[model samples]
Target chain A: MSGEGWVAVVGTGPAGPEWLTPETAGILEQATDLVGYGPYLDRVAAGHQRRHASDNREELARAGHALDLAAEGAKVAVVSGGDPGVFAMGAAVLEAVDRDTAGRWRDVEVTVHPGVSAMQAAAARLGAPLGADFCAISLSDNLKPLAVVERRVRLAAEAGLVMALYNPASRARPWQLGRVLEVLGEVHPPQTPVIFATAAGRGDQERLTVTTLAEADPARADMRTLVLVGIPATRVLQRPDGTLRVYTPRYYEEAE
Target chain B: MSGEGWVAVVGTGPAGPEWLTPETAGILEQATDLVGYGPYLDRVAAGHQRRHASDNREELARAGHALDLAAEGAKVAVVSGGDPGVFAMGAAVLEAVDRDTAGRWRDVEVTVHPGVSAMQAAAARLGAPLGADFCAISLSDNLKPLAVVERRVRLAAEAGLVMALYNPASRARPWQLGRVLEVLGEVHPPQTPVIFATAAGRGDQERLTVTTLAEADPARADMRTLVLVGIPATRVLQRPDGTLRVYTPRYYEEAE
Candidate 1:
């Protein structure tokens, strides 16, 4: 393994070409190898760079492979969908580096670059529902216990913070979203607004549904969805055309 | 007031030109007026567009002015540092639109474009400290009460969520950061890693400091700084050159 190579973990920011930042594009342009999940790797334009596509659940393996290639003098770019640092490949790459027992990749310079996150994209589509203090929780119980997820949702709701829930539902675990909504219902008011944004930033596939806590159905969400639950200060307004816009007020009325 | 105008609220993503997205740049190119705080408005390249810069504390007025410009048949872009949807100008603009009486600007279309947020930028610099669930809390009590901020911190800390603290301190509110630290100390371990990233994404002014909760000083942070508090799964590693990197592991050991 040589010390001449480096690895950069970058995010494409959802699924649009317009969302890619110049910094990430620069790294992608200079990379000798690109590694990521199949769909995310497909986002980049086909070029001379060697592609290492893998399953979505194989983040650690992919990270280790990228590090090994970088240690062997290959400039590698690990691609992710949203911001690499937020529930993405950046941590997986670092975890691989930490587990490098032989220290072979010590000289391989690793850098993580920022990108727009799913929550940010969803919030933008919904007109700034997360304009105040907000929490991002992954509803997947694969990494943490459901009890912990429930407790965090309840606490965040009680604190009156807007909540952005990612990985709301998967085929394997179908009941997580219902439980989350149940926990949210116990803390927030029935009229609290909820937003379901699916495939945001992915033109043509984007869909947004706005409802309230009492009427928000868990069936409206899937793995591709990002759900936002509002606090008491959140408002829902209707346009003349009957479209609804939701936003959380920057200031609390009673706080003043 | 006319129906032929629109306003796009876009974020510049902390600082630096590379952080600006193509989507935001396209909007900026077509805008007839740019409305935002003086520093944020200064980010755009001066052109034929009219500048409507205001004080940092006057987000609502700035937003209303932007709406007025749009209603008068001008294309306006409201610039914010980092994602406008996240505690920036996006919500303020929506609030102003909602408060518009007599519906003078009813036909004025408003949209928010997502940008890299300060937390995402800071986490990238610190090597993915926000890999899992995280919360963004603005320490400034100008909008909400200090009690509300403190309660949210305690609940978020207790939930084991990595926290990104924004506006940690200001000239007039020096005690909020200390109180946040005191509350965090009660829930998190003393050895928990804390990161201070100032002026992130700004080419020459970016600075990062790594320390533990027990040793972290509130004075090290300012309004331009973003502070990250890690969970038990977070780790700090050193390269052969003695440079440090911090990251929270993607998977919890006990969860499996």
Candidate 2:
């Protein structure tokens, strides 16, 4: 597909402008219009030559605006932190473009440029917590029913898959992660390795704590937090000086 | 930690030298000794001021050598592709430095700089398969046991977590991922979305077909291939032109 008038869904990496991949930066620089949650657009350095539509509450509207602009033959960039295809705006963009009124927007090229997710950034800091089979689920029931979230948590725990919890808690959903733990407790032991990482890669980044499922306190978590729960085989080794690291034992390595 | 004889663990991003994060590049430029797997060393285009230890095998040996050099006051940079800490030699360096023979190296400072992981690279090209709660498991049983692999696979599948399968198959371990599919079939449906991504960032990069669990052929997979399996909640939407895109339902946004 020709690249002109395309909608580029770009992942800006974890934090800061430097983490943005070259491909993402190039799309942002070349786009005629920019659309995203407000904070993400703010992440781009000043003096980029793109018009902006930044609104956190009206995501669908923003996505529609980007698609409308792209349909009008304007190159647009929908910015996301991490990757657009994950939980970000890539799907929303596609949905907006595919709507009956803007069916022609479908012909406009779409490209997704990936960025590092918070789970990865946190895993990178701690060690290879994600080296083995894992699962990522947001504890918030803002959209899905609590029953569904519980079911996924219980099943994932029973499977002994490492779990990355996104949107664990917000002001309105403060007890979400705690509720997830309550469900997970039914299958996973209390000693499961749990790592809570917040604001990973940002200058104001704080809070990298290693604890067990029983010890995890959702009160300390926030929207910025990314919680990682390891399976039964996962272990947290503490150094003599008190630094803790997490690893999932493959067990096969020892068979040799 | 003063930048003096400290070691910095850097990631080379996807492929191009420009893809390297500035912080990672700066660390390489400032280091007095470079230590990493041989293939990774070749990716760094910038010239380093000091010596380097490069090899195809012997990751642990390279870490020991780097730490020994750092003990003698050499500023070291231990490098890896994507991120040093993901599945790379960063942990090996840490383990080696923490050993008793590394008494001098213990006092040496260490910093881990994050980079793009292969999963992220693949997810970027395909939309956001890695954004939701996903598990990444290396199919290679060299350092891990097949039982552990089966357990994790079962758990991840049962939890309805998306999966990024690494080291899916190699010359000697050709049947590993195929066996993993058999384990997954017990829990997951046969029609789950599976993506095979290869050579993510390079010019020759290719993202192959998305098929169902029942139709997946592990024989076609290799060490360089990154396989992504979508969860039950994931939907593969087909465009009017017959193009398919995979996405997971985040539920919360829909409620809003």
Compared with the true structure, all predictions reach lDDT values of 0.86, 0.70
Residue-level lDDT for A8 in candidate 1: 95
- Look at candidate 1 and give me any clashing residue pairs: none
Q: In candidate 2 chain A, where is summed lDDT lowest over 10 consecutive residues?
A: A247-256
Candidate 1 stretches greater than 4 Å from native? A1-3, B1-3, B253-256
Per-residue accuracy of model 2 over B1-256 as CA lDDT, tens digit each: 3655766777887677656776677777777777876667778746645547476467667877777777678888888887665667666666655454636666666666678777777776666555455667776546566777788688667656778887787556677788888887777778877888777767766656778789988776766688888776666656655666666655533211
Give lDDT tens digits, candidate 1, residues B96-165. Answer: 8899878987988888999998988888886999998889888765777788788889988877788999
Residue A213, candidate 2: Cα error in Å is: 3.1
Best by TM-score: 1
DockQ of 2: 0.44
lDDT of 2 by residue, A47-105 (tens): 65475757655556777787777778888888887767667787666555545473656
DockQ score of each predicted structure, in the order shown: 0.82, 0.44
